[model samples]
Target: MTTAAPDLAAETRDALDADVAALRRGATLWTRLSLDQRATLLESIHASTSAVMAEWADVAATSKGLPPGHPLRGEEWLTGPYMTLVSTEWLARTLRTLAGGGNPLDGVRMDETAAGRLRAHVFPGDLSDRLIVSGFTGEVWFDRDVTMARARAAAGLGQRTPDRSGGIGLVLGAGNITSIPVADVLYELFASNRVSLLKVNPTQDTLVPVFERALAPLIEMGLLRIVTGGGDVGAYLTRHDEIDHVHITGSAQTFDAIVWGVGEDGAARKASGRPLLTTPITAELGGVSPIIVVPGDWSEADLAFQAEHVATMRLQNSGHNCVAGQILILSEDWPQREAFMDHVRRAVAATPSREVWYPRAAKRLDALRDAHPEASWSDDGRRAVIPFDGGAADNLEVVEQFAPVLGVTALPGLGQDFLDTAIAYADERLTGTLGANILIDPVAQTRLGDGFERALERLRYGTIAVNAWTAVGFLTPALPWGAYPGGTLDDAPSGIGVVHNALLLDRIDRAVVRGPFRPFPRSLTALRPASRGAFSLLPKPPWFTTARTGASVSAGLTRYRAGGGLLRLIPTMLNAFRA
Candidate 1:
């Protein structure tokens, strides 16, 4: 099987260049547009995309080598248009508030009466209150001073300073998730008043058309641009003389390379306390995300649901995601370890072998197996569920495997032992800190609350999700997503800073917390429904017959169209949450 080199045609290049120029112009106009005008345009874009959800999903699925009605196809349906609509709506409302000269953060009061004395409270019925309150843990607060400062700076630029009117921004898009780069560009243009040049990842060229169409409103408005190619293209745009600021979602290696330049000369320059080039770049990099399995008396349904949840985290986008749960930290003495592992293995084996998107995934899995030959293997390369017996945790396989592979390490003893072991493993190994997933029951939360909190505090990861996968944190626009805060130039594992939903925040670099959800249900886990007619409407649902999948999907989507709003959104959100 020979793979052909990518063809970068002159026509494509010209289109990309035109789009870039359009975006550059759009950015200027976007800044000048009254926030209400911008909000109106955003609404139009959302409405347009929503109207053609199935078409967009088909295109996205076809590009990814999936059938027109694959479950992953629904990703574009749910995450792409749905997310765009939700995010755009939120941004539009936020912009309206900004335009009204009313700070969205105004209702959240914070005071420091004395040194080291901090008090924060939210006014009832405020958007800020509704926005920050997490369904998982109730209320979430940020450093109000830092958030206000950034908001003021962003707001003041247009009003107080004429020179800061057109801020040039460079957006480096993520290769995996289709919506990230698009959302990043939108945020820069609308949320922060920055003119953006979007650099598409080499791996995600298929999404270029979708973005082009979805963001046409912004392009017509003269506020956003889309550019494509590989390293040369990225470097050219990032180092372009016109770009004022940069934002990227990729690996820490990529981030470091951009910031310090690459190779020996770059290293020397970095060591000399002089960056090869000076451009402020914000990044949301990868992490050695861990899933902590607390000791619990889980039911069969619980085990099955969790297995599917864990599997979904790995299998989504073929495990190329930055927020994928890579590690499973469990208690060896826990009676459910064997049962959990069994359930996980069944889930992995049940899932079809998806097309591995990342080039080096096979190599990474091979390396991991070499380090631990006893590791289990499925006939299909899509699954690797390896559990370690009681032993040392200092191996390459234990450290990382960039594939649909999971490393299971068992900690001896009870509550403190489990917490200490997880912390030690995270501290000793793990590569990045984009986010972590922790599965804990109410019993464990109560028994190990202090220890788990302390462990969370000690853990190096950025976003921590208790009892759930960190992917939820990424999907939910309410939370900030990035590297763990407080990391410096010396230590880059956790990377630096934060992105996403920090609409008004600046100082926050990391978020660590837990989620409270009922134990998983079997209906959410199984691929096949017991009844034929029940889920026949879902195209390519685990149970769908490939030949008739199209009709089923059409029927289901028709139902969705007929009964729109909360009725449709509720089930979709539930499915996404379970996934």
Candidate 2:
């Protein structure tokens, strides 16, 4: 009575061809559908995906070698399915508005501040409306608008076509986060008017079924396809003759390989001013994210909250995440460094150790420790928590670890020196700028606003969070998640381009600075007993006093789910008001 599963390779190939063919049929048929129809499709997708939430959690946990019903599993579930649904719904509505001939750029005035920066004041319910939807940073301006045109012209680019029409796109997905590929495809198709052929990473091959089911609406509509396997499949799809554009969310190594091709021939070609191939490839690569803890943070609650924030950033996905805060930069003369380290150590000790899933994670950890023997190790070697002493510059711990580990370094003095040291370390030592977490008190932030902003400006990282973990920006759908501006073929930090939240279709290329009033309660930053409990209880948290409050807050996010804005806002407002 049960049907056998189809051959995955064959199905994937067929799906890819079908999706491309459908997109080649032109945008008229796809664009002609009413906004309500698109919303309905998205709603259906969400509903179907929600039904299998528990199954998805189980698969993630089993694959990662975690105990049954682990808290980290619940964290992944909330992030992958639950948060994705909310983002999709919000974007669907935004698309509906755009399709109705509502000028997305209405009320947004653009001003060019400098050579690389453009400041825009977007009106409510406009194309840039979603910029302020959540905790996202950066301004939004329509590429075709007069202001943007002027800005582009000022930047010395000649008259370029402002074709708003969408086209076919190929999405190369990251294996770390389950929803990245899905979110990227959604951004390209619905938000940017393009059909997508998603190339899944080998690490996430097992989740193909879940993806297929979640994307059934697009699959049925022939607008999206999910393909699996390895390098051969990715190269085949990326080099497809019919492909119009490409977007990848992975490592810089992978991005460079794609752009210049691999091996000695490719390197020679790149050096000779001729790439092995020429294709318009955009990407969001990895980073050794930094967390800056300001000097004047005192209260026990503040310490606890900040410690948890740092731990969660590292522990999430076993530090396989590109946005994980690997470096903790603190002021050595602050006098609270010892207390902070003590709290942080306690938090890490309390966190339950889970096996890292990324290939060669153990080797990478070993390499890091060998390079920096002083680095502290957990009893099981599954985790490393290295705390740097104040007076050492030649220590190995100052180097990048790039594993399920954290390196705590202290910079003496405050004011400009602190800012300068932090920026210098990030620019010179860190591997990438995909994410950064900076913690500053209100007084310090206000007094050092100019210096702090300057430091943020100097930071090469893509997403910089203030007084909160980088994960907040990662979870917030409104942010254009990617690297900083002016990243070229020569320098690939912060990778290239943006993804997440299909609503605004923003073409931003810089830092997203998130300023939270206080550290998030029940944050997964630094590992702690509360975090362990939060992760365990996340799949199904009690309505009250749950550690996975974000998931609970997310559960009632949609206006449709709640009767309207008033109802949906109530829960979020309550959290904010309480905070």
Candidate 3:
């Protein structure tokens, strides 16, 4: 009779009070199910996350060190479980188009953005996203006081009405993308009809048993739970009192220690705005993104393919991506600015030195090499590259050296007055409005026509991309990822609302995206060389980090997006033509 080993902090407070009383009775049975039972419970959670997505990309590439068949372990199977089965197959095709009454933006395509706002045209979104990423494109843009019949009666999940009162949220995930806590637990259970719990993020505690066997149909219909401990179990489930809301992805110093209250009483409750948690939080956090580039008349293979596309937008995950691309800007009277920075230092020394895997990443790359002590280091002090020059760009444009550091700088004027002073120096010197990347050169955007969409509507950033990589709007689930929407809760900056939208859109303002600066058969050399135009077969981008068969074409495009037909696109087009 040796039954006394159960006191581990009273069995973790009785298993977090029975998982918050089974998510407060599964938040009114997950808002009374419907919408075709939440599209057959997200198609049984996309067939249990496509049958354990190769053991969740082999335990997230062996917890970041990437062991088995590591060609950057195809960035842990395209950012984990193939972006959680592409956000559970686009929010179960927008809950089977609102349970067949239609209007998941019925036949999509809309227009109107010279900044008047209202765009739409979301990705190819058909003919299998134009045969898999062929000349990619996407758009969304809305909030200029969204119209068109209030963006069609506020698209998706019928913008909540009739007493379907959702409640128990909490999430707080993201420990460096293993599908950001299964896309923030399928956006708090099928786009905010709540009933979640998630937690996880103790650097992804081995993906909490592969997210409880891939979200066992929303934790066997108690809606969801999936806990894990650390930071006092996320400060006792963020002051748990049957938690009503709180999103969080991570870091704005943990969203001000969960809305003020840690050291020195969270700096006197964030300087007296008094918030020890009123429980209505939402965040995404992290900044210093920028990439810019816009000069013109390029080609030494377009400056070695956009300097390996700006070293795969700052060495992909090794830059601990919060929309990576940590500053590169450029222009300083562009005469191929030092030959496109000598092919961005040979594309950040030909990509492959990884594993400084997040947590204190070598003491933040040794405090960014003690504030750029003549930067350029690599032989495993884990890549640097700095540059700056111009009052050394105010400490890497407001510190966000997540690691694998890039920096660069420049800025002056040329075409369209250098893309309007690099879009007002990335909207008043970049820190983070989430994402931004520009590149240009499709004949310098047809010689800055309409000053290249008024420099993408004067870039404020919440997914910009163009010539692609705001981590492709965080692996596109019909794009909407956060920030640039008047952030608050005491100066949020890059920590506000929005998440993998999947057409449950409401007021959203950004998400542009575009691609094919060159890559397939060198993008058919922009359709028969000798100048600029563009076409696409779209290769070389299995999320590039010098992609040579980025781990068998991101594990054969995650079993051809978890359906595996047409012979899994003949081994993902023969491993993306061997990258």
Error of 3 at 457 (Å): 26
Better of 1 and 3 by lDDT: 3
* Sort by lDDT, top down from the best: 3, 2, 1
Question: TM-score of predicted model 3?
Answer: 0.35
Which regions of candidate 1 are displaced past 4 Å?
Answer: 1-27, 105-163, 388-400, 449-455, 487-490, 512-563, 567-579
Q: What is the lDDT of candidate 3?
A: 0.80
lDDT of 3 by residue, 1-579 (tens): 011222347678678878889878877776677777777888788888889999888888888887886678888888888888878888888777777777778888888976578888878787666666777888888888888779878787433451365688888788988888778767766666787888888878987888898889888888888888777777777777777888988778778877886799889988989988888988989788888888888879878888988998988878887888888889889988999888888888888876887888789788778877988877466888888765634767876777788988787888888778877887887776888888887877876666588668878888898888888778888888988888898888688878888888888888888888887776775766554455777667778788788788788878788887776587687768768
Error of 2 at 190 (Å): 3.4
- Cα lDDT tens digits, model 1, 1-579, are 001113455575456556556656655665556667766887877766666655666665666667854545554454455556656655665567777877655565554322222223321223322222222331123343544465445532232322244477888988777778877876666445687778888767776777777777776666677777887567656665556788888877787777777899778877887764466767777766777776888788668767776776666666677777777778889998889989888877666555665778777777767776777777465557777653554443234445777777777766767777776776666677677777765556667655665666566666777655676566555456777666655456655666556244444434544343342232222223431111111112221111123233333433343336545644543342322
Candidate 1: C-alpha RMSD to true structure equals 7.8
Better of 2 and 3 by lDDT: 3
Evaluate candidate 3 by giving its C-alpha RMSD to the native, one decimal: 21.6
lDDT of 1 at 289: 73
Q: Please, what are the lDDT tens digits per residue for candidate 2 over residues 1-579?
A: 002222346766666567677767644456656655766777878776776655665675577776764545545665677556766766655555555655334344556433335655321233222321332234333232335655333320100111344667888888888778888887776656677778788877778888888788787776776777677667666666677778988777777776777899768766876754355667788767778787875678667656766777787778788877787888888878888888787676666667866888788888767766776677388777876553545333333344678888887778667877888777777677677777776556667756766676676666667654566566656556777655666567656667663435444544354444343343233234422111111221211112344333433343223233454455554543232
The clash number for model 3 is 3
* Cα TM-score of candidate 1: 0.79
